[model samples]
Target: MAANYDYEEAPGSYDDVNRQDLGYDPNFVPDSVKSFVVHLYRHIREKNVYEIHQMYENSFQTLSDRLFKDTPWPSVDAVSHYVDNDQVFCLLYREM
Candidate 1:
């Protein structure tokens, strides 16, 4: 199912890593995942709604494949809960 997340630019600096530096080691998240997330955030910061939606629609399947290649299927309830929370967060940011 397609997620219904509105694109909204958050207030303040868009550089989340720098602005909210949690002092974690540079290698915490793998480089590949970090790169993907950074790219996604850049589109959001630029308010490129079409591109963001395109990227999510095009890449999520591949991303999920890579992320869960060897893992058991996630529960439907868990997935629904996560997606709902994500939608809420997206709405909150859009309202900012």
Candidate 2:
């Protein structure tokens, strides 16, 4: 089953190291495994939306600093959702 979540742009330009470095598939993951990640991701986005105006605001200095350590931060448009096999993943995409 697919699920939809409301999300805003993440505060910085960081990518998910778990997905990137590990070459893991969001689909086919276990619910218990992904639940914590989803929760943390949402918590960060919620906090950022409550603080930042522009994607550049990067108002959450700690999160912003770590995330955009070496890259330019992008602007996010909306939250995206997907389900593969029995696993589900959601993300915030920056608008080009």
| RMSD (CA, angstroms), candidate 2 | 11.5
lDDT of residue 68 for candidate 1 = 29
lDDT of 1 by residue, 1-96 (tens): 433222222223233333245432332332333444445556776788886676566654444354424443233333333334355434532332
What does candidate 2's lDDT look like per residue over 13-72, in tens digits?
Answer: 234453335453333232322332344455454675442333324322333354434543
Question: Which candidate wins on lDDT?
Answer: 1
Any runs in candidate 2 off by more than 4 Å, and if so which? 1-59, 78-96
Q: Which TM-score value belongs to model 2?
A: 0.23
Worst 10 residues of 1 by lDDT: 4-13
Q: Candidate 1, TM-score vs. the true structure?
A: 0.41
Tell me the lDDT of model 2 at 20: 37
- After best superposition, candidate 2 residue 79: deviation in angstroms? 6.1
Clashes in model 1: which pairs? none
lDDT of 2 at 66: 45
